[model samples]
Target: MPCDACATAAGDPTGAEFLTTKSRLLRLLAPLLAAALVAACSTRAPLPAAPPAATPAPAPAPTGPLTGQPAPNKSRWVPVAWSELPGFDADALHEAWNAWLRSCERPAPAFVPLCGDVRRLSIASGEEQRAWMVERLQPYRVESLEGTSDGLLTGYFEPFLEAARQPGNGFDVPLYRPPADLTTRRPWYTRQQIDTLPEARAQLAGRAIAWVRDPVAALVLHIQGSGRLAVREADGSTRLVRVAFAGTNDQPYKSVGRWLLDQGLVRDATWPGISAWTQANPQRVQEMLWANPRYVFFREEPLDALDAAFGPRGAQGVPLTPGRSIAVDRLSIPYGTPVWLASSGPTAQLSRLVLAQDTGSAIVGAVRADYFTGWGEQAGDVAGRLKQNLRLWALWPK
Candidate 1:
C-alpha cells in the first residue's frame, strides 16, 4: 500500500527517491510488504518437533556421478550438464554477480580462492560471465530423498512498519528486545502467554523498542525476523531504524495461516485474506495470533539512504541482493553456493542465477527454497504469490 513510489521503486535499487521515502511511506502502506511478510511469517512456524538430531552424512566432493557425501537431511544431488539448465543463456549474469560478490563477503572455503576471478568478472559481459561459470564451477541438480526433482519455492522480504516512541494514539502493541533470561530458558512464553501472563509481560516491560498500532503488524515483524521502523520521535519528527532478529523464545512455531485454513475461517490463506479476517473479527485478533506459539526478539540498528536499498544480512553474513538472492536449507546446499533456479508462477517466469545466501525454518527440504524478493510492496506481491514448482542446480567451484 506504499505510494506508487514505494511500490514501483522498491525493486529498482537506483531509485534515490524510493530509498528516501521508503521507510516513511512504507509504514503508511503496510500492504506493500505485507504479502511477503505473511509468507515468511507463516513459513517460520516450527516444524513438528523434530526427532533427535541424526548423525549428518558426509557431504559429497565437487565431482562424480550422482554419488558422494549425503546432504544433512534427505536431499540428494545429481550431477548435471550446463546444457540442462533452462534459460541459462537468457539470464542477466551481472545481476547474479552482485549477489555473488555479496556472498564473497564471507565466502566458503572453496569460494575463497576464486574471489579474485569473481571480482574480475564484474565488468564482464553476460556471455563472458556465463563462460566463467561454465569454466570454473560444476552444476549439481538437487533432489529430494524421494528422488523427486521438484519441490516448493516460496518468497519473503524485509518489512517496514510505522511506530511511535511511546504507546498512545492506537500505538499500543510493543516490539520488544530479548529478556535477560531468554538465553537461559529452554522454551519461553507462548504468544498467548506473553499477551495475558503478568510475569511474561513484566520481563519485557522495559524492553519495548517501539510501539505500533496493530498487534498484527507487530506479529508480522516477529515472523519476518527483521523490519524497518519509522519512528515518531518526541520532537514530532520521524526517524527510521531497522530491527533485526536477535533471538527467539525457543518455542515451536505454528503456522497461523494453516490454522485459519484448518479452521475454515478463511478460503484463501494469503495476507489480504488474513487481514480481512482480522478486521472483521477484531475481538478474535488475539485468538488468531495465539494460534502460533513462537515469539521473536529484535535489536535495533540505524537505517539511512545507503542502507535502505539492501536487505538484512542472510545466513551467509552478507547483505542480500534483491532478485538474485535465495534462502536454501543450509544442510542441503551450503551457504555461499551459487545456484541456477528455474521456477515459473503467476508472478514471474524466473530462470536465473541466484546465491544461496539465507535460510528459513520452512525451507527444510533439499530442493526447497525461499526467494528473497527484496523490500517494499512490489517485492511482497511477487513473494506472496510465488509458491511454484522449482528446479535447482548448485554451481560449485570445480
Candidate 2:
C-alpha cells in the first residue's frame, strides 16, 4: 500500500523495478527472505572468453645460409663418384642432354642441374668477355646486368674476367683449380700437395674478399644480411666497411669473422689442434667460431673432408679417396651437374672433376666456390681451416 504512485518514484525502473518488486514481495513475506543484491549491474552479456593467446612461433633452428626445411634431398645428392664415371656413362649423359634440348629448345641439364657444375668457358681476357658481350648486345644496346637481372651468367662474370682474371692471380699463377686440372686433369692443390702458389703467402693475418650481390633467393639474402657485421671504431665509431671471407691457412679470405681472427693472428694451431678445441666448446660452437675467423672455411683444400652435419668437403670411403663439396652459380651451373676440373703446376694437387653437390648463400658466379668440411668434428675443424686460390672449368664432350 505504499501505492502505484510510488512505482514512478522508484526510479528509471527497468532494473530498479525488479529491485522494487523484489523488496515489496520480500517485505510482504517478512523475515523469510534471504539477502540479495545486484552483483554485476548496468548490464550487457558477459564477454566471450578471450581466445587463448596465440601460441608463439617456434624459434628457427641454428644454421648457416640454409633455411626452411632444407632441400629435402639435401643429403641424397653426393659428390659425383666419378672414379669410373659412376653410374651414367658419357653416352647416357649425351642422350639426356640431346633429349632435353630437343624437347625444351634450351640448354639441357648438362648445362645446369640441381647443384651441378658446368665447364666455365675460359675467356683469356676482359677483351674476350667484352667481345662476347658486344655480340650479345650489338653496341646499340648499352645493356648492363649489374645490380639488375640474375647477373650470374653475365654481370657477375665480367668482374672476374676484368678484375680477378682467373689464371692471372696478381702476376702469374698456375694454381687455379680448373686451370691446373685443364692443364693436368688434377686440382691445383691437394691434401698431400699444394701447387706452386703463384700468389704470395697470406701476409701476416691478411685475408681476401669477394662479392655476391643481389642474389635470387631470400635464403641467400638473409645470410648475406646476417653475415654482414658493422666494423665499430674506437670512441664508439666505425670507419671502413667490408664483406669478409675465411682465409686459407693456405690462401687468403676476409670474412668479418676471419678478419677479426686474422687481426688476432693465430699461429700455433695446426689442423689437429683446432679439432680438439671445437670438441671442448661444443655448446657455443658457431658463436665461438664465428667470433674467430680462424675456424671459418672460405676456400683452399680442407685438411680432411665434408660432413653434412658440419659444412662441406672431405674423404668418404675405405679405399682412401677424396670427398668433396662445392657451391656454384645456379644460373650458369645447375645443381646435380657433374663437372670435370683441371689445374696447373708440377703436382697433381687440385685436378679432378667432382660433383657440384652443395650450394651456399654468397657462392655466386661461374668461378665461385665453397669447399665442404667433412663429417664430424674433424671435418668441421678442417673446413674452418680453408682459403685458397681457384680456377673453374665445366666438363663436356669434346
**lDDT: which candidate is best?**
1
Question: lDDT values of the candidates?
Answer: 0.71, 0.25
lDDT of 1: 0.71
Clashes in predicted model 2? 57
Candidate 1, 1-398: lDDT as tens digits = 10111111111111111112244465653544454344334222211221221332224344553323334465677776777777776676787787888888899887888889899999999978877777777778888888888877777766666789999998898989999989787799988899899999999989999998777766665766777778888898777788888888888767667788889998867777777787788898788889878888888988765566567888778887777888887888888889988877665667778899888766677888777776644555556666777889887776
Question: Residue-wise lDDT of candidate 2 within 254-277, one digit each (tens)?
Answer: 232233245453333432333344
Of the candidates shown, which would achieve the greatest TM-score relative to the real structure? Answer: 1
Candidate 1 ranges beyond 4 A from true positions: 1-73
Clashing pairs in 1: 1-31, 1-32, 32-377, 46-253, 59-69, 60-69
Total clashing residue pairs per candidate?
A: 6, 57
